[model samples]
Target chain A: MMIPLADLVTILPELIVVSAACLLLVLDPITPSNKKDLLAWMSVATLGVCFVVTAGSMGDRVFAFSDLVVVDGYASFWKLLLYVVSAMTILLSIGYLKEERIDLAEFYGFVLLSLTGMMIMVSGADLLVIYLGIELMSISLYIMAGFKRFEAKSIESSAKYFILGAFSSGLLLYGISLIFGATGSTRLVEIAAAVDARGLDDSMILIALMLVIVGFGFKVAAVPFHMWTPDVYQGAPTSVTAFMAVASKAASFGAFLRVMLEGFGGMKPNWSGLILGVCILTLILGNLVAIVQTNVKRMLAYSSIAHAGYALIGLVVAGWVGTEAGVSAKGVSSMMLYLAVYSFMTLGAFSIVAILRRGGEEGEDLDDFTGLAKRHKGAAFLMLLFMVSLAGIPPTAGFIGKFYLFMAAVNAGLTWLAVVGLIFAAVSAFYYLRVVMVMYMREPSPDQEGETRLALSPTAFVVLALAAAGVILFGLYPWPLVSLTATAALP
Target chain B: MSVPVEFYMVLSGLVFIIGLVGVLVRKNLIIILLSIELMLNATNINFVAFSSHFGNLSGQVFVFFALTVAAAEVAVGLAIIIALYRHHASINVDDFRLLKW
Candidate 1:
C-alpha cells in the first residue's frame, strides 16, 4: 500500500494545477475587484510552471498510483500541449474579459481547473481515472461557458452543454462498467491483458466499446454528436470559445487515442469501420455545412468538427496500419503529430478572433471583420496567417498536419478516404479564404466604429507569435517535429 | 444469493432509452436535465450491480466517482438553467433559439 514518492514526482504537473485551482478558489474573496487581473496572471503563471514541470519529464516514463496514472512520452506530449494551450487561452481571455466586463477571479480559476482535468484525462491509465478527469474538465467548462451571467445565449449554451455532457458521461461510465464486467478490471493495461488471456470477444465488451466511442464522440464534436458545438461556440465569450475549440478538442483526442490504442487494441477490427464511416460523414458534413454559415465563429465551429474528422483518419489509420501491418508505433505517432499541429493552428486561429474584439464589442460575425486590414494591420496579417494555415496552404503547419495524416492513411491502404478528405479540404478552403478576402478586400464598415485601432495584450501577442511561428516554422522544417513525433511510441 | 445480470441490463437499458427520448422529444429544459440525471443514475446502478456480480470493487469505486460527477453536473446545469430562465423568462427549449441553422 506504500506509494512511492518518485511516482508522485512524475505527475507533478497535475498536482501543480490542482493546488493552483484550490488556491484561486480561496483567494477569490480576499482579492478586491480592482486587483482581479492578478488572478489571471496567477493562472498564467501556474500553467507556466506546469509546462516547465511537464517539459522536465520529457522522455521519462513511470507509472504512478499502482499503475492507474502513467507518465510516458505520449502523456508528456499531451500534457505539454494542454499546458501551452491553457496558457494561451488565459492570455486571450485577458483582453476579452476586460472588454466584456467579465473580470472575475473564478473565471481564471475555472480555466486552470478545467485544464487540470484535461491534463489528468490524457495521463489516466485506469478507466475510473479517465472518467474523473473528464468530469473535472466538463464541470469547469460548463461554468466558464456561462461566465457571462447576463448574456442569454451564454446561459443557454452552457445549459445545453451541461445536459448533453452529463448524458454522455453516463454512457461512458456504463460502457466502462460493461467492459469491467467482461474483463474484470478497469485498468486499461489490465483489461487488455484479460482480453488476451481469455481470448474473449464478448458482445458485452463490444457494446461497451461502442458506448465509450459515442461518449467521446460527443466530446470531440464529431458528426451526429456535435449538436452543441456551434451553439456553444457562438454563445460563449470569444475567449472561452477559443479555449473550447483548441484545448478541449486536443484533450479529448488525447484521451481518445489512449483509450483506443491502449485499452481496445484487440477490438480494432470491430470499431475501425465505424470510426471510418463517422470520419467520412463528419468531414463531408462539417465542411459542406460550414460553407453556408454567415457567422465566422459558427463557421469555425463546423470547421473544428471537420478537423476532428481529419484527426480521426489518423486514428483509424493508426489502429489498422500500426497493428495490422505491424508498424507498431509509426501510425500512432502520426496521429499524435496531427493532434499537436492541429492544436497550434486552431489556437492561433481563435487567437485572432480574440484579438479583434475591441472597444467592448465581441466581433464574432464575418461582417464584423470587414476591412479589418485597414483598421489593425498586424492583427489582420495574423488573421490571414491563421486562415491560410487552416486552409492547409503550403508553408503553414496545417498543411503538414493534413499531409502526414493523409500519408498515414494511404500507408494503411485507406487511399479512398484520403482522397475524399482532400476533396472536403478543398471545399473547406472557400470558407477559410472568405475570411481572408473580407479582411483584405472589403471596405471598413462605418458602423464598425471601434476604438478605431486594436491593441494586443502581452499574452495575446505571445500566443500570436508562437502560433504564427509554429505554423510557418513547422511547415518549413517539419522534419524535427516529425522525428520527435515518430519517437514518441504508444503503449 | 445471486441476482440475474439480465435484470440490471434491462433496467439500465430502459433508463438510457428514457433519456434518449427526453433529449429527442422533450421541450421543457428542466425535464431534459432530469432525464440526464436519470440516465446517469442508471449507469451508477449498472456499475454497482456489475461490481457485486463480479465480486470486485472497481465497479463500486467507479460508481462512487460517477455519483460525484453527476452531483457536480447537476449543480452546474441548474445554475445555467437558472441563468437562461432569467434572460429568456422561460424554461422551454423551444423558447431558446437565437442561433438557428
Candidate 2:
C-alpha cells in the first residue's frame, strides 16, 4: 500500500515528537554523563518546535490517510494545549530531576512520546487510530511513573497504574468491537451515519456506550473508577504527577469530547443520564474525601478527581443541549478554558511541593508545609495564589471557568445538576483554604531558628511566574481565550 | 461453516469475567498482570470476530494494534513488578501498602 505524503505532513507534530524521542535515545550515550542538562534543553526545544508546527496547522481542516486522522481547529487547539503543558512539564522536571538525582534521558524522552500519543488521540478520527494513540500515550506514562526505580513507592504506583490502565483499555477495545459489529464501521463519522441509517436498538447502543464510558471514565478518574489516582499521584515523582494531572486529564477529556460529539451524537439521550450520575458522585465523593487527607499530594489527587467531575458537567451540558443550538460549542469551550487554567495552577502547586524537598527526601506532607510563608515568602505567595484559584475564588481563572460551566449547564436546562455542583464547590473551598491558612497563619517548626533559607531555583521561579501570570491574566481578560475556544468547534 | 455471533460474544464475556475475577481476587502482583493480558486478549478476539463478521479489515487491523499494545503493556508491567520485587522482596499485593489510608 502506497501511503500518501500529504497525510504525513498533516501529522507533523507526532512525527516531530517521535523523532525527538529517537534522537534522545541515541544521543544520551554519546553525551558526557554530567552534561545531562543538555538533553533536558533538547527536549524542551523539541516540544517548542512541535508547538510551532501544531500552531502552523491552525484554522485549517483536512482529512488524511483515508480519513483515519483529521486536522481541524479542534485538533489544533488540543494539540497546542498538550504541547504547552508538555513544555512546562519539561521545565518543571529539570530542578525536580536534579533534586531527586534522577537525571535520565529516557524520562524526558518518554514524556515527549506520551505527549505525541496525546496529540494523535485528540486528532484520531478512526477507532484504530484512537486506540493506537491511547496506547502510545499510556505505555510511555507507565515507564515515566516508575522512573525513580530505587523508590519502592514509585514502583508500586507504576504497577497499580499499569494494571488499572490495561483493564480500561481492554474495556474500550471490546466496546469498539461491539459498536463495529452493530454498525459495521469503525470510522467515527461513518459509525454515526451508520447508526442513523440502521436505527439500532436502545439496549445494544447502551451496552456499547457503557463500556466506552467505563474505559474513558477510568482515564479521567471518575468516581467508582478512581481507586488508583491518589496512590499513583502521591507515589509518582512530583513532576510526573503534575504531567499526569494536567496533560493526561486534558488528553482524556479531548478524546471524550471527540467521541461523544462526533461518534455518538445521535445517542446523546442514552448516555447523558449515566454521565450526570457519575459527575455528581465524583463531585461529592472527591471533594468530601479530600478534606480528610493530610498528605498534600493525595489531597491534590482527589482535587483532580473533583475537577474531572466539573469538566464532566460541561460535557453533560454539551450533550444535553444538542448541536443545532451551538450550546455544545460553548460547553466545550468552557471545558478548554478550564483545562488551560487548571494546568497552570496544578503545575505550580506541584512545583512548590518539589521545591520543599530537603536532602532528596519527599517532604510533601501538610505538616511539612507549615509556616511556609515565613520560610519562603515568594513560594508561599505563589502557592496561596494557586490554592485560591483552585478554590474558585474571584479574580482568579478558576472562578471564571466554573462560572462559564455553570452558565452552560443552566443554558442546557441542567439546573439541578448545576446546583449540586455549586454546593460541592463550596464544600471544596474548605480544603483549598486550609492550605492557604497553613501557609499564612501557622508558625515555622523550631528545628533551626536561623536557617530561614529559601532555595529558589531558576526552574521553580519560571513555574511560579507562568502559573501566577496565567491565573491573573486569564482571570482578568478571559475573553480572548474564550473566543478562541468557542471558534474551535468539533466536527 | 458460519460461527454464530452469540458464541463469540459468550466466549469473550467468559474470558473478561475470569480476568475480572483474577484482578479482584488475586494476591500476587504478577498474577494480576497476567490477568490484564488475558482481558486484552479477550478484547482482541472480539475485535477479530467482529471484523470477520462484518467483512471489514479494520477490525483485524485493530487486533494487530491491540496485540502490539498488549506487548508494550506487558513489558512495562513486568518492569514495574521487578522494581517492586527488588524493593520489598515480595510480590504480595497486601504487603504493598505504602500509600493506604
Candidate 3:
C-alpha cells in the first residue's frame, strides 16, 4: 500500500495542477461573478508553476509507481506542451468568456483538470493509466464544450463529443483487454517484451492493434474517424476548440506514439503500414474537404486533421528508420515538434476568431473576415502570420514543423511518403492563403463599412501576441525545440 | 461438463457485438449510453477471463478500473443528455442534429 518517493516526485506536476484546480473550485463559490477572471489568471499561474516543476525535474529517466508512470524527457516534453496549450487556451478564453457572458469559475477549473489528465496521459507507461487519463481529459472536455448552456449548438457539441468519445473509449478498452490476453500484461514494456519473445503473427495482437488505432484515430481526427471534429470545432466555443485542436490532439498523438513505439515496438513493421495508409487518406481528405468549407473554424478543423496526417508521417519514419542519433528515437521528436508548432499557429488563428466575437455573434463565417486588414491592422497582421505559417511558409513555426517532419521522413528513407506529404502541403496553401487574400484584397461591403471594430481584451491580445512570437521565434531558431524533443525522443 | 475459457470468451464477444450494434443502430440517447456500458462490461468480462487464464492480478485489476470509469462516464453522459434535452426538447440521437457537414 505504500507509494514510492519516486512516484510522488514524478506525480508532482499532476498534483500541483489538480490541487490548484480543486482550490479554484472551492474558491469559486465565494468569489463574485465579476471577478471570475481572477480564477483564470490564477489557473494560468498554477500551470506556469507546473511548467517550471516539470522543467526542473528533467534529469533522471525514472519509472515510478511500479513503472506505471515515467519521468523521462518525453514526458517532460509533452507536459510542457500541455501546460503551454492550456495556459494559452485560458488566456484566449478570458477575453472570449467576458464577451459572451460565460464568466464561470468552473471553466478555468476544468481547463486545469483536463490539463492534469493530459499530463497523466503523456507520462503514463501502463495501458490502464493511459486509458484513465484519456477518460479524465475527455469528460472534462465534453462538459467544457457545453459551457454555453443555453445555446443549442454548444449542447449538441457536448452530446456528440461525449457519445463518440465514449464509443472510442470502449473500443480502446477492448483493445487493451485483447492485448492483455495475448501478452498477459498491461504494462507497455512487458507487452513489448512479450511481442519480442512470442513474435507478431498472432491474429489477436493484430486485432488489438487495429482497435487501438481506431480509438486514437478518432482522438487525433484522422480521416475515416474524423466525423466529430468539424461539428465540434464549429460548435464549441472558440477557446474550447483551440484547447481540443491542440492540447487534446497532442495528448492523443503522445499516447499513440508511446503505445506504438514502446508497447508494440517489436511489431513496428505491422503498425507502420497501417499508419501509412491512414496517413495518406487523412492528408487527402483533410486538405480537399477543407477547401470547400467557407466557415473558418471548420476549415481549421480540417486543417488540424491534415496536420495529423503530416505528423503520422513522422510516426512511420520514426518506426521505419528512426531519428538522426539512432540512439534516441527520431520519429516522436519530429511529431512532438510538429504538434508544438501546431499549437501556437492554430491557437493564434483561433484567438483571432475569439477576438471577433462581440455583441453575441460568433465571427466564424468566411465573410466575417473580409476586409479585416482595413478594420484592424494588428489583428489582421497576426492572423496573416498564423495562416502563412499554417501553410508552411518560411519565417514561421509551421514551416519549420513541417520541415522537421519531412526531413525525418527523408532521413528514414521515406522520400516517397515525404513527396506525397509535399503535394498535400501545396494543396493546403490554397485554402490557408485564401484567408489571407480575403483579409488584404477584399473591400468592406456597404453595410459592413462603418461597423465598429471588435475589441481585443488585454489577455487575448497577449495570447495572440505570444502565439505569434512563438511561431516566428521557433521558425527562425528551431534548434532549441529540436534538441529538447530529440533528447525526449525515446524513453 | 466443464465450460472452456473459449466459451466464456465467445459469450463476451457476442455480448460485445450486440452492444456495439445497439450503439450504432439505436436512436435513443439513453439507450445508446446503456449500449456503451454494455460494451464496457463485455470488456470487463474479457479482462476477468484473461486474468483467470493468465493467473495474473492485473486483468482483474483492470476490470475494477474499467467499471469505475464506465460509471463516471454514464454520469457525465446523462448530464450531457439532460442539457441537450433542455434545449432540443427530445432525447433522440437523430433529432440532435444542430451540427453537420
Candidate 4:
C-alpha cells in the first residue's frame, strides 16, 4: 500500500503530539537544569495544540493509515479527555517534583508519548494497531512508575508492574492471535463481519473473546486480575499514581470498549455473562478491601478498581446493545462520559494526595486529613466535594455518570445486575464519607502541633478547583455532555 | 503432507503454558522476564503458523511487530530490574516487597 500525505492529515492530533515529543526528547539533555520547567511548559503547550486539533476532528468520520486507525466522536472524546489529563498531570507535578528533588525533564516527554499512545489506542481499528498502542502506553507507564530512581519502592513498583504487565500483554497477544485464527483478520470491522457471516456458535471465537476479555480485565484492573493495583499505587510517586489511576486506566477502557463492542458485538450473549461476573466481583472486592486500608493512596487505588468495575457495567450494557447505529441506549458512550467524569474526580482526589504534606513528610495517611477543615477551608471543602462525588452522591458528576450507567443497564434489561451494582454503590459510601468526617469533624492530631498550614502550588490549586467545578457544574447541568456522549457512540 | 494446524496450535499452547508457569513460579525477576519473552515467542509461533496455514501475510507481519515491541518491553523491563537491584542489592522478587499491603 502506498502511503499518502492526506492520510496523515486525518491524524493531525497524533502527528502534532509525536513531533512535539521528539522535539522535547531532543531538547531535554541540551537544556540547562533550571530551565527544565520550560520543557514542561512547552509540553503542555504541545498538548494544548493537540487538544485543539483533536477537537477540530470531533464528529468527523475518518479513518487513517489504511483504516488501521479510525476517527470519530468516540476517539475524539477520549483524546480530548486524555489531553486534559496530560496537561493537568504536568501542571500538578512541576512543584512536587522540585520539592521532592526528583526532577527529570524526560518525564514530560514520556507523558506525551503515553498520551499519544492513548490517542492511537482510541483511534485504532486494527488489533495490531491497538496492541502496539497498548505496549506504547504500558512500557512508558512502567518507566514513569520508577521515575524516582533513588526510591526503593518506586523501582520495586516498576519491576512488579513490568513483569505482571508483560505477562498480561502476552495474554492479550495470544488472544489477538486466537482471534485472528478464528476470523482471519486483525481488523475489527472485518472480524465483526466474519462473525456475522460465519455465525456466533464458533467455539474458537468464543474462547478467543474470553481470552481477550481477560487481557483487558488486567489493563482496567478488574477484580481477578487486579492484584497489582494497590502495591503499585502506594509505591509510585503520587503524581504518577494519579496519572496512572486516571489517564492510563481510562485509556484502557477506551481500547476495551472498542475491541469488545466493535469486534465482538456479535457475541454479546456469550460474553455479557463473563463481564457481568467480573463487574460484580470488582465492585464487591474493590469496596470491601478499601475499607480496611489506612493509606490514602492505596484506598484510592481500590476505589479506582471499584470505579473500573462500575465502568465495566457500561460495557456489559453495551454488549447487549446490538449493532444498529441508530439505537437509543448507547451504553458505551455513557461509559465514555463516565470515564471523563471519573478521570477528573480521580484527578482531584489524587491531586490532593499529590500536593498535601504534614510535617516534613508528604501526606498520604488518612490521619493527614484530620482537622483539615478547621485549618484550610477551601482545600477541605474541595476534598469534601471530591469524596462525596466519588461515593456517587447526588449533585456531583459521579452521580450523573452512575445514573447513566444504571439507566443503560436497565434499558438493556439487566436489572438484576444493575440492582446489585446499586447496593454496592451504596456500600462504597462508608469509606468516602469517612474521609469527609475526619477532615471536618475530628480534632487535629497532637503529634503535628504547629503544622496546620495547608500548602498548595498555584497550578495544583487550579487543577483541583477545575476538577471540582467540573463535577458540580456537570452534575447540575449534564445536558450538553449527555448529548455529546450520546452522539459519540461507537460505530 | 504438511503438518496439521491443530499440531501447531497445541505446540504453541504448550510453550505458552510453560512460559506462564515459569513466570508464576520463578523467584528471579530476570528469569521471570525471560519467561515473559518465552510467552511472547509462543504467540509469535501461533501468529506465523496461522499466517502460513491461511496463506496471508498480515498475521506474519503482526508477528514482526510483536517481536519488536517485545524487545522494547524487555529493554525497559531490564532497566527497571537493574534499578531495583541497585537499590536493594538483590534481584529476588521476594526481597522486593517494600510497598505491599
C-alpha lDDT of all candidate models, in order? 0.83, 0.85, 0.89, 0.88
The estimated TM-scores of all candidates read 0.96, 0.97, 0.98, 0.97
Q: Is the docking of candidate 4 incorrect, acceptable, medium or high quality?
A: high
lDDT for predicted candidate 2 compared with the true structure: 0.85
lDDT of 3 at B95: 89
Model 1 per-residue lDDT tens digits across residues A41-123: 88889888888877777887789888999888888888887888888888877766876788787888898889989988999
Which segments of candidate 2 are over 4 A away from where they belong? A200-202, A321-324, A448-455
- Residue A33 error, candidate 1, Å: 2.8
- Which residue pairs of candidate 3 clash? A323-A330
Best by DockQ: 3
Residue-level lDDT of model 4, residues B19-53, one tens digit each, is 99999999998899889998899899989999999
Q: Judged by DockQ cut-offs, is candidate 1 incorrect, acceptable, medium or high?
A: medium
Q: Every model's DockQ, to 2 decimals? A: 0.70, 0.73, 0.84, 0.83
Residues A71-92 of candidate 2 have per-residue lDDT tens digits of 8999898888888788888888
Using DockQ as the measure, name the better of candidate 2 and candidate 3. Answer: 3
Clashes per model (N, Cα, C within 3 A): 0, 0, 1, 0
Candidate 4 chain A minimal-lDDT segment of 10 residues: A320-329
